[model samples]
Target: MSNGRKNSMQRVSDSPRLLRLGAGASPARDKQWFCNPGSGAWPPPTIPGRIMMMNPDQNSDPLFDFADADDYQRLRDLLAAAGFLDESVLEAIGINDLPDLASDHPLLLDRTAGGSALHTLIRLFLMEMPVEADTFAQAIRPMAADSWLQAGLVRRHGSQVTAALKLLPFRNLILAFDLPALLQTPQRSRYVMGIGGSTITLSQLTIRRHCRQTLDLGCGCGVHAFLAAPHSSRVAAVDLNPRAVRLAAFNARLNNISNVDCLEGDFFGPVAERQFDLIISNPPFVISPESRFIYRDAGLEADSVCRRIARQAPAFLTEGGFCQILCNWAEKDGGDWGQQLAQWFGGSNCDVWVMRSESLSPAAYGSKWIRHTEFSDGETGFSQRFHQWLDYYERLGIASFGAGLITMRRRSNGTNWFCADESPERMIGPCGEDVARGFALRDFLETVQEDAALLACRLRFSPDLRLEQQFTPSAQGWQVSGSTIQLARGLAFQGNSDTFMANLMIHCDGKRTLQELLPDMAAALKADPARLAPLVCQLIRKLVEQGFLLPAGQENES
Candidate 1:
């Protein structure tokens, strides 16, 4: 207590007693307020408010999800005008008879606790399309021509086909519409959790550093737009579906982002030209068995997604800008996927980096799509759809489908190609951005045919730590062990290049603890222990996490 008092008095003697502001007056209003009345001294710290908070979370409460009667009516009016619902059809289909509708739309039409683009009323209406017929499932198709529905209970549901298209999961439906503004965000699992190879590839591969103006083609829910808006000065995301466009706009507003402008258009036909540092897309590349979701299942025949992206991306890209995309393409007539993509450049001076990131057997790919639409487990039509896919694959002689990161830079200099096509033996996160560097891209692409990018990493031990045990190559995977208890928690190290890996392994001596070996490592690696501390700490942490190193006892560090 005496020592504490002494410290307190010392603090008081060293500190200044600043002037006070009057009640309700900001301290900033009085410039001379900082002066101590007793000591007439300056404060110790120069930069005030340095420790203050800058960024604040906007939402503190949960947002409302259900629509009230008044809000519902307002939404109903808006949707009606947006071509979502037809009054006459609503009457005919008996929207008032909610219980009856629930029987048909077993998964939907319950008018439950929530309402959304995929709610009971919306899904049922969207599925039933031009006229929802209770009698014929075929006639219930929103896109089926009138003549196909010469039956009873053919009730018209939506004034416009786009609304119905947005919700339809049927194989025969057309994907000519967009998502509405309300549902386009990561807040919905339909956008965020739904991400696959296509989304990840685009996110990682596309270069964002130097871009000023960028375009996100077919920006569903504006996922890419959200990413691009922060990195670039201006980004324009365009989607063919009106609903998707509105959803994209809604996403922008929700994030308080103003730089992204969402537009509705079909392909590059609606996109403005002659300006963009980069263009990115994950277009509807799935060669569809039917035209159902135009956003995903490309209707155009034969490498349509790849061809369209290749054809349109060139128009908007700046002189030195690049177009990066993830596309599904066929290996046709003994033609390599790389060669096919190269031909798409049409002898231009553009450099292409096509790394076949993934490959799947026709059956596996076909089954996945079938399950997505619920066709695989559905009653009767699903089997037909599955067989139809098999027939399509057989007819095309498609050994397997390939998907990967594709980057094209508009440079008039030398053209270089990189191919890292094989699936990795063990890949955790991503290699797309790394693969995009011009040198890396070209090197990987050129060397990919041999399938070695799959196992490219060279494992080694740390330079600053001792190798406790060494194991030579055996019949199994890498059978090597080393102890790095003091300097590091683990024995593992990373070497991207072979020479570095070899050099690191050579330095892992069994004799020295990390502290004892510090001087030698400092001399050899040209950095002192203090200088190398941070790097060593990080490497040690990673090694500990991987079980190559163990944590030290508390008494050891002291």
Candidate 2:
């Protein structure tokens, strides 16, 4: 490890002592010391100091309380009956996309002005706007308004009732979480974030194979855990923020998900002895100078939190298990960022694949992150944070910040391989199966390193593969000037190709081995089979890696 990384680890190690001081102490005292009022210390104190004592009767909290499982089920059924699902709400709101921030609520409310039950529900829950008591009562007919108020779903104010939390209908599951506006307050440090870009990316990147046990490290509002519930026999969701843990547990109950257990602790400390078949984390990975938010910032310096997770996650994973994390890491000046990442997995016994989506210069990175939370802060505050972050990056010699998904699969028996590359520009939908297939393909490629072995394997083009040809008008009746091949969905990887490669792909129907196809290919090109064989093998390897082509038996895997 580098000296910077060592220092970061030491800082993290020293945090526990501060936390030990608050052991067996009252929650009020803990909160008072950890969150010093008017101190203006961004995250108030150290990372460990943010750990709050979880209430024994967390479920009974007015904001989180639901009468019972049946009440939860009733609320779900009522929403469904009122057309309050993701698709229905989107259609009713005259928007194709769901509202991500509180700023989008005005448009949603305007579009959902119709006085129907669905519109009323949308205004009440989705828009987080207060509705008249009679309108709210009429909207939830079967269930009385008092029931809703008693369950803490809504709070009455004069003649109107407002939802206490934001209820999002996501992927057929309803997740209740802290409102977006909460992030602007002093309590923002512990505010639980709802669905966002990182959450969606990690969900799509995760390998969805059914497992005996799964872990959602730094799970906020239990979204990942709920997504993993049906596929996993049991899931454990852990976070350091007590409020996040409480809300995640509340979300599980609201969604009627019994297999998930939400716990409050830092990193893997809560589940030290437990092993999981799958582990997914979208931890506090912003590489910032200040730790202002538990959901976005880890108090450790640089990208130490992500590095620590990469180094320690393997021990908690079972053989053949997988751990996927969405994170940001520093790119040092004149250094290979990929190599730096590879070192994090040294002796981890895991095959690692890093799909870096984007990298931004230190100035750009600092500005973007500072603006995310400090947008409400006037110009002076924003400028101060931006300069402070830039100075921190300069002092640490950071050139840029790279953000993306890191997927690791444990393999105890063989030599682990590390693959790092830029990810596809866009993903159409869930690509969990593609992730699993990528791992399998890498394993196959490692075994068939020899040309002879590769030639013996049969291959087929992916069903979603597409070929595009570009032509110029000046070139005699639309003659092809360039051609490219791409996938229609999933990772959506694309690459430049030629007529010959396209024809070769047409022949890859899993009916003929590469050795058998080489003769035909060479004959079409009027070339020697020996020369064409090497070129074809290389192309095939590239196609398989990009997921445009799959080995025979793997066609049906995804």
Candidate 3:
């Protein structure tokens, strides 16, 4: 509602605002916009279900294709017999190239890039049991009955799906998939892993009251950037690897999304002074001595990527903007991750919600990164990479590490900070909106508390809202109402609150009576006296802001 934000949103939301996003617009500080390339509109993916993540064919046209269970299985068997399914090819060739593969494992070197990549797709995903008893059906299983595969192939060689998939090599991605369906895959599949989940999670939690610009730092293959393109006037997608930038661009083209501007740069440098309404990232959290391949490792800095992301976000978020991230951190000699997060807020009225999804010791962490390189087929080098991870952790004195999802919101209040670990039990569906509400509500609470001491407070939770009864004392100065009180129907105030919050506080100067406060209250709200009087009276029926008309004092005071 701020003037600056209003103008920014208006300018960015042009009907033709869906062009390549101006990734450099700093939404954290200045309200001004930079480059604006007006593409008609975002080519949003038409989803068949409420769950967009499972829908891979999220485009006007889809280039990647999937096969039916029986036929796809037959293709897999043929490829395996031809050596295309071997791990050796996966390790050496890199999965993206397909057309050149013509040897015995033609799928490995002679097939089109998209189709060749499909083989790696299978190699990366976990195998689902065949519906029948026999695990080996002489061919590859489609891995899923998902529609993303059958929805029609993604554009193959060029702009159109059929056009892009002009050749047999490309057609395989459409006709014969390599990986299992994401929806059908088991909980944790080695074959299907990457930054997809993190980006999706962050996207759900982003606050969009109309974002002028947005940025996806460390945008691997540009999936996150693509998602952000729809809501933002302009979007900037950045990654360190040239190949990643190319792939991200390719993905954008495939998705028919023109608003995302893929850039090559490290965090915050390319987007200097550009503030945004939202910033999201699934940065490299896997702690490694060296950030090899730029795909997984966060480098020798040990949580440096996460820390930098946290530290830099506030600088770019507008007064009411927000940033969300997923990261992994080292737990040093009893140091709690929550404490570190608290410090990261930098006194901004920021609320941080983190869900500790998993924790692993130094050895376990090392092995996970080691396995990512398994496709390389160099046993000795794999061992070396594994040892490097262990050495990095040991030398840094890391005992255990934790990984989690985080969302931060910049509030109107100056420099207030909140930190807590979210319950994994409640991390269902998508938690983006829940996280955003936490920040927005926290901001509202801070503003409200300034007018009244919640010494005696109660909360009557609504069924429609996802909330819990909880209270916290801020350095023993102020305490919030507990879930029990908030979930109840009545207010147990110290005294009857006979007036609106602003009315009560203003007239609390001790000279004005109820009659005297009515005029100011009506004027502030611009409401009629008849309607206003009863509303103010009903507030007193329970305890309102002014502590003069309620039940026994301290009824539920902690």
Candidate 4:
């Protein structure tokens, strides 16, 4: 951490720019909190399985109630019947209100047909449009409209019924998140988030094997924890925002996910002295000078969240466990980024793989986030906030910010490796399996260091691996540019290749070991066996690591 970050941390203790966050402040008054439907005036009610700030109150709570399993099942059936539960249906209807897109797209024009209970629910929840009182009542048959009003999920205006939360479909699950436009309101800081690109990316990359326990740190809407529930015996999800935890708890129940335990507190504060087989987070990792929102900004200076989490994660991980997180790191003035990241895992007993997806310049990065928060250029203090963000980066001597995924595995003994590489822009399909295979290959390389040892191992080309040759018609008549070889699935690695290497790949059919193929390969290349041996060994290692080739037994795994 830099001196600037240290100073910033001290400044954040009483940051005038920031409002009081969940510190006895009323939800309606506090900009850092969203209205929790379940709480009352002063200290909130102590709900079961929740850590609440206690103060015995004369008035009973008037707002939100958690949904029961029966309500959830009815809700699920209703949504599924109406086709609102499928991602394709939502996409076709242009229901994904991502930032900067026109919300009033034509597809949503006729959404409120009121043809059935599902359409009414979709119009009410998905479209964020108010439905008629009688229709809304009939749509939610078992659960009355009065129940929704009491739960703070809806409000009544004349004969209209309006929803407070946005119930969006996410990968075979429905998540009730704080409204996206809520951030633009006066109370704009701590709205629980809906499914976005980052959330989807983190879930896709998570290793999904059955595990003893999983921990989702900074689990805003508990998407990761909910997804991990069926795969793990138990899931403990923690967040800094109380409102977020409440909503997450609601989502878990709405989806009838019984295994997740939602807790409220700062990072690692709620789940102390606990170990997990898999630990995952898409934390507030924005490299900003100010902490406007708990979901996006960590407030611990530039990239400190990433550094702190990586360092602390090892102690909480079981042997051979995996801790995966999506993070951003500032590129320091004098140091290399790879080395800077490697230092994050310095004292940990974990093998780290930092797969960089993109690097953004200060201006571009600042503008993107500003738009995300819905702060326009014409807004008051917009210039000050934007300049402060840029000045913060410049003061730290940061050239750029690297955004990527960091996957770490605890290795009890042996030498730990820190590998940093750029990954493909678009990863295809479920890549958790590819990530696991890559780790196995890395471990194999570590053990089989010698050329002889590598040659003894039988290798087969990955089923999805492909080799393509490109040529262009020039003055020399169709000269070849180069041969490219890559995995067609998962991480989608593409690289240059040659005729000999291509042929070598074909010969690696799992039946023959590299040592056996060496004599024939040398003869085909008109070279000595000693020279071909080293080249073949090196190529095999590279291919295996990239998932273009797999060791014999491993080919059957994925």
- Against the unseen true structure, what C-alpha lDDT does each candidate score? 0.45, 0.75, 0.46, 0.71
Cα lDDT for residue 119, candidate 1: 37
Query: lDDT tens string, model 3, 119-205?
Result: 333322212111221222212344332332342322222221221111122212212221223213331111212333444445444
Clashes, model 4: 3
Better of 1 and 2 by lDDT: 2
Q: For this target, which candidate reaches the highest lDDT against the unseen true structure? A: 2
User: What value does the lDDT take at residue 375 in candidate 2?
Assistant: 60
Q: lDDT per residue, candidate 1, 1-558, as tens digits?
A: 000011111111111101110112232221211122345332212122111111212342111111122332343343344334334324434565322443665443343214332333354444443323432333233323342222111234454222222331111111122222212433221221123335544564557665778888777766677777778877777655443554454345434456666655555543444368888777666655665545446566646656767766766677777887766777655766666667777755566656554566778877766666452246577777878988988887777776655677776655544333332222224333333433332333344333233112222232334334455676896665432222232111222222222343354343334444445656667777677654544443334322223222211211
Off by over 4 Å in 1: 1-197, 333-335, 375-379, 418-420, 423-433, 438-558
Arranged by lDDT with the best first, the candidates are 2, 4, 3, 1
Ranking, TM-score, top scorer first? 2, 4, 3, 1
Candidate 2 residue pairs in backbone clash: none
Give the Å error, residue 496, model 1: 12
Q: Could you give the C-alpha RMSD of every candidate to the true structure, in order shown?
A: 22.7, 9.0, 17.1, 7.7
Q: Whose TM-score is higher: candidate 1's or candidate 3's?
A: 3
User: Worst 10-residue stretch by lDDT in candidate 1?
Assistant: 1-10
TM-score between candidate 4 and the true structure: 0.84
By TM-score, the better pick of 2 and 4 is: 2
Model 2 Cα lDDT, one tens digit per residue, 283-364: 7777777766666677788888888889889999999999998778888877788998888999999999987777788888
